[model samples]
Target chain A: MAENPTPTPARPRDAAIGTGLGRVLLLVYGIFALSASARALVQISSHFSEAPLAYLLSGFAGLVYIAATVGLAIGGERGRILALVSCSIELLGVLVVGTLSIADAVAFPDDTVWSHYGSGYGYVPLVLPFIGLWWLWRNRPRP
Target chain B: MNGPLSLATIVVALVLGVWYVIRCALNKAPSNTDLWSMLGLGLLVVVLVVVAIVGLFGPDRPADWTTFVGYLITTIAFAPVGVYLARLEPTRWGLLILAVAALTLPVLVLRLQQIAEVTSG
Candidate 1:
């Protein structure tokens, strides 16, 4: 595509902590971080005993989002590794959780972020990990 | 959420979504005016959230008051967050952020309505 002719000045390799695109991803990741964590906070505070499994899963998803945000915000070798691992886990989490939620409804009495491919959140949670992974892959250190 | 205010926010958001998508099609970053327009939309959202907050005092208050509050915070913050991110890129992606936020607002509003529907009464 003729779009995006100018490469971002801040290359991911150099670990320039903040680029425009990084800023954008930070916003999105930040939102997810806030939402997931907030969801967990509310769920746990009101009724932790209702469904410990679902509540814990929601908190885990929030942590992954927070990790991804920090990784993208940090932007270096370590950051890359952090982002890579978190996004990979996120992908697996979403796929497995989505399937499990559908296959066995009794287990998931309430919704986690990844339940049913994040259908509750319009599947953005499902798609976000893929995009996060792609961005990290694109910016991976060259051999 | 089921009120005119929520509907207005959703409709405005959708219209803005289309506008931003068109701007992206043209490969243009958000201009100063665009940012201002976003801020204006943010004002509208603020009003909507305020109204929703007032609704909380009514006897029809939803059972899930805490979750309703959570959505209120998110809805109000949405536009400014978009503006902040859009300012950073100065490219089509900036507009895309706006587009994403605009599209997401409707969902947030819907969620608010859903939570509010399960009232204690």
Candidate 2:
């Protein structure tokens, strides 16, 4: 039995954030970015007076999602830091906003992406930040 | 948007989305057939969108035309975009990407229906 011998070109295992499962994360983040931003734009532009706090929160959430998406896609030291900060903030934002939105309905008459633990988005928003953080931690630079 | 065509699109997308996810769970990267099925779903969505666009000119249009059109454009473009990204990553995760895209389509279509229901009364 002769074993076939051929030089298999070694592909560089660049531990970028936007590779493998990270690519799937990027896609999900991209979808949230578009959706959150578009929803914020519509809410703020059409009726900012209706729910100023909710609309502003929506806008902020959108920016955070956008930052995370960009950071993951870029995947450098700076990008990792950016993604870390944004994802942390995102986790905090969803937790605080989700609780507040439910505890006090008057303040959040309109729903943001983080409202009620992202129930409007099938709770994906609530879970995304955690995933983002895990991905970052998994791909952390070695000493 | 509340027609049989849109319903069919939603059903097809859900079925394909589940199939893709199952395949991914079984550790299968998306094959050509899988990708092509997605493209076929994209074409169906296009037909649904075109029908909605034609209906837009008729009376009793939705009050929020801009948002309606925005969702329409998103729905039409989503599947192909998924196919493109999945092609770039030929792994189980790529199949998950298509799965996510397919699942999101039903939500988008439902949202379109909701927006379209708001006629100027």
Candidate 3:
């Protein structure tokens, strides 16, 4: 943490994934990772028969969030690609699940993280992927 | 639960959340006071969780005890985790880290209250 009187050189694009607002995204993703996984664990363990599909989806959502968090934390070319895929999946999952949960409530007897566009957890689930993708795109390497 | 301690923690967190976000928006790094305030919040959370634990042994224990405990762990860890990340970044984003953590603490407390309300009949 020594202060360098001279200006530091510009950092490479590899470190872009975790700079500026990307750090905020990382914290949010980490929160979702914990919440989604913990919720899935409770649902699957406590009453698996009640809503197996929903519980499994919750587990999947948790994994996606975990990947996104890791990808953002480890900023580099690999991390960018990892985050891109995870964000894309997150976006699709929320949209598909959100629409289906609304259209066919019977099928979604229980709620996953994406159910009803994440109404239970606020609309963050729906909005998070877009921000994540934008961050990834903004940080994409320019050759 | 809806205890005074929980209410206090939520209020303090929200107030600090607003302050931190504003600081970040103004492009200020998390200063020493800002970081210390976060640590103070963490200490308050510790007290709140400890009280909740004591309440768990009361006559009207929550039916979903496991979930309640899970939330307690999350709530307690929230602030310190933010502080750790904030220290690492040493920039405006560090303040945002505090802002996000502070914002999330209230939600965690509210969730804890909901879970605690479902007592065994």
Winning model by lDDT = 2
Per-residue lDDT of candidate 2, residues A7-35 (tens digit): 55542232344366877888899999999
* Residue pairs in clash, model 1: none
Ranking by DockQ: 3, 2, 1
Alpha carbon lDDT of each predicted model: 0.85, 0.89, 0.88
Pitting candidate 2 against candidate 3, the one with the higher lDDT is 2
Off by over 4 Å in 3: A3-18
lDDT of 1 by residue, B32-84 (tens): 87788788889999988887888798889989888899899989999998898
lDDT (10s digit) by residue, model 2, range B30-99:
8999999999999999999998998798887889888899999999999999999888878898899999
Please list the residue runs of candidate 2 whose C-alpha ends up more than 4 Å from where it truly belongs after superposition.
A1-18
How displaced is residue A27 in candidate 3, in Å?
A: 1.3
Q: Rate residue B42 of model 2 by lDDT.
A: 99
How well does candidate 2 score on lDDT at residue A80?
84
- Supply DockQ values for each candidate: 0.41, 0.44, 0.67
Error of 1 at B117 (Å): 1.2
Taking the tens digit of each residue's C-alpha lDDT, what string does model 1 give over A57-84?
9999999999988887787888888988
> Which candidate leads the pack in DockQ?
3
Please report, as a residue range, the 10-residue window in candidate 1 chain B with the lowest summed lDDT: B1-10
Candidate achieving higher TM-score, 1 or 3: 3
